[model samples]
Target: MIELITATQLDYFDNLYIEMKGDAVERDDYIVAETKRGFEMLRVVKSNYRVPKDNIVEPDGRFVRLATDEDVKAFDKNDGMARESLSFCKEAVVEEKLDMQLVNAKYTLDRKKLIFNFTADERVDFRNLVRILANRFKTRIELRQIGVRDEAKYLGGIGPCGRAHCCSTFLGDFVPVSIQMAKNQDLSLSPTKISGACGRLMCCLNYEDEYYEDAREQMPDVGQTIDTPDGRAVVIGMNILDLVVKVKYKDDYIREYHCDELNAVGEV
Candidate 1:
């Protein structure tokens, strides 16, 4: 009996499945005699823009070669994973009908559970969708909906920045960011200038919001009249990052001063 599948095993099976199915290489197991080669972990997606150039799963966990018709029966008795996979496929049919795509799907070693990964433009009403899958599959079914940011991370991509996208490369989860953070940082209000490829405000904004707020506390608001060494002037703008304020004085002369110096000169 093929005890466990290795990387070579996954690779061989993947190649065979790809060749056999052409444009539709759904994941499959390969039967092979164990060797020194490693196995890779694998996940199923509706489709991938870039297919793996090599093997999938690592050889660390319990694995085996392709199951023959007779082997399948024996597997059903001993392996819960095989049993669950069949149910997952059935559930996928209905889920596919509802969404047209599934992102990441996986099953447990024991055929006790199935997980579906997906993305949508807005909230999805899968009440009927879930019931149909549950009754037909006869096992646990879970559907996880993710955002485009999460999708980009799941599939992986080069971000608008020089490095890989944060969501994909390293950010396991997203932090909240807001437009006010941009205003605090004195960033251009234009969406494109501050937003990430995800079309949301950059996650970096959250990082500096506290500092911006602290700085704003030290500085006074614009349009407030305040005294300067030269003369009194109306505050026109604030430099949040530098903690400086621009004061408009006589003859249209404008100068920025430190916040602490505002009180030293005179009252507003």
Candidate 2:
């Protein structure tokens, strides 16, 4: 069966794979479907492989089906249905362009829908630009404003950790992330350190945030003055996973102890 994995928007993010109940084709292979996000070629593998099924991976939810080429073509024919667009503001090195990276160039198949995908630092004024594209395409047009992460998904690049970009590779939706998650994980506050190419906090930070929170609750705060092996001292640092705390006792003297040695903590 041809499954359709549509992005909530054409942000070039991963889309969900739908395994519709009572599906006619229960094949051992996965089929490809086209959404505004591009194309998804998914195949079914042995459940014993232990790879997550459906949207359990992240940003879950997509519509699966047995789609025919005719179905895709007809949807594309609706000019305004599937196309997204972006209008150029000021003249650039290329041409008057909107804030979009051209993933595909040239119009084919009678210009089904003119979809504009762009990222803007501030609210843009592009009424006249839209008018220009509408007249040029002679069909319906759509403009999609995406975040920095979406652009990374559209362009496809390697991440700082030497892995494929997560937004495009597996993630579908941009789950909420906060700096607090970073703080809980003890990540650097620098934007470049924690933020992804999308200029937003990395999605990974949320993975262990709850664990950190739970761990923190079981132990004393880092700055609290607590009794330790060396002596009564103030906690200078902590390791949540190791359940260890560093206490500062005397001049330039610090000691590390597991939570098991911890005693009643005094006020900082």
Candidate 3:
């Protein structure tokens, strides 16, 4: 099992895991560590999570030690520097007239690497910008282009649900959320209704999908012919939560029946 922590306090910071090396590290402990990208100083938000035995740690970055008062001071200083660097990068983007929206900036604990995140509708050539930043900051520069969903995840805000976004608060990574998940749950097909603040399909759509899938298998599809206790009927609608079906009889009489009360004779 490997332990890890988030590298920055930035609300825009995604899950940048820095693996904890020793047992001394605990939750909320500020520590210095090396990440795949570069050396980082991160606070341990989580600790002692199990990893599957079959899975090997990729590009293992080691935990150096818990942070001291001096270390905290240095971290704060680097944070201020990160903000300055972000401002610097934004100005450089304008000077170069690049088509990109800068998101956030981060600096390695050793101050040797500066990572910049941005989002663009299409591929952007920031090669000249990187050179300018490298020369200005006197460090390694990384320009990362992220998707819209990722941008929303990085910079979280109150969702339409009037709560914090799941991506920034709890989700470790994005799971595939398709339009079918919405259909399976009998949700409104309206994009605005189903799409999240990210302008992508809502992550919440996946939440009840498993139950809906199981319920769907048990319940007859709309317009399907079925033999009910009342009579042979055509399914008109469903109450997935109640495991019940609404059917229309040949006489045009409509009634609701429990799924178990009906036999799926055939499709109409």
Best by TM-score: 3
CA lDDT scores, all candidates in order: 0.58, 0.57, 0.77
- lDDT string for model 2 (1-268, tens) is 1222223122211232443333433334433444443334333322112234563333223434555575446445533333333223223303555444444222222354456566677666567666776676576555566667777777677888889777766565678999999888777899999988777888888878888998888778877887765567888898888888888886868888888777433332
RMSD of each: 13.9, 7.4, 4.5
Q: What is the lDDT of residue 228 in candidate 1?
A: 79
- Candidate maximizing lDDT: 3
As for lDDT, the candidate ahead, 2 or 3, is 3
For model 1, the superposed segments whose C-alpha errors exceed 4 Å read 1-97, 105-114, 122-142, 266-268
lDDT digits (tens) for residues 104-152 of candidate 1: 5544334455566677766667767667666866767777786766656
A best-first ranking of the candidates according to their TM-score comes to 3, 2, 1
Error of 1 at 27 (Å): 31
Per-model tally of clashing residue pairs: 19, 17, 0
Question: TM-score for every candidate vs. truth?
Answer: 0.52, 0.62, 0.83
Question: Where does candidate 3 stray beyond 4 Å?
Answer: 7-22, 54-60, 250-253, 263-268
When sorted by lDDT, best at the front, the candidate numbers are 3, 1, 2
For candidate 2, the per-residue lDDT at 177 reads: 95
Candidate 3 at residue 122, lDDT? 92
Find the number of clashing residue pairs for candidate 1. 19
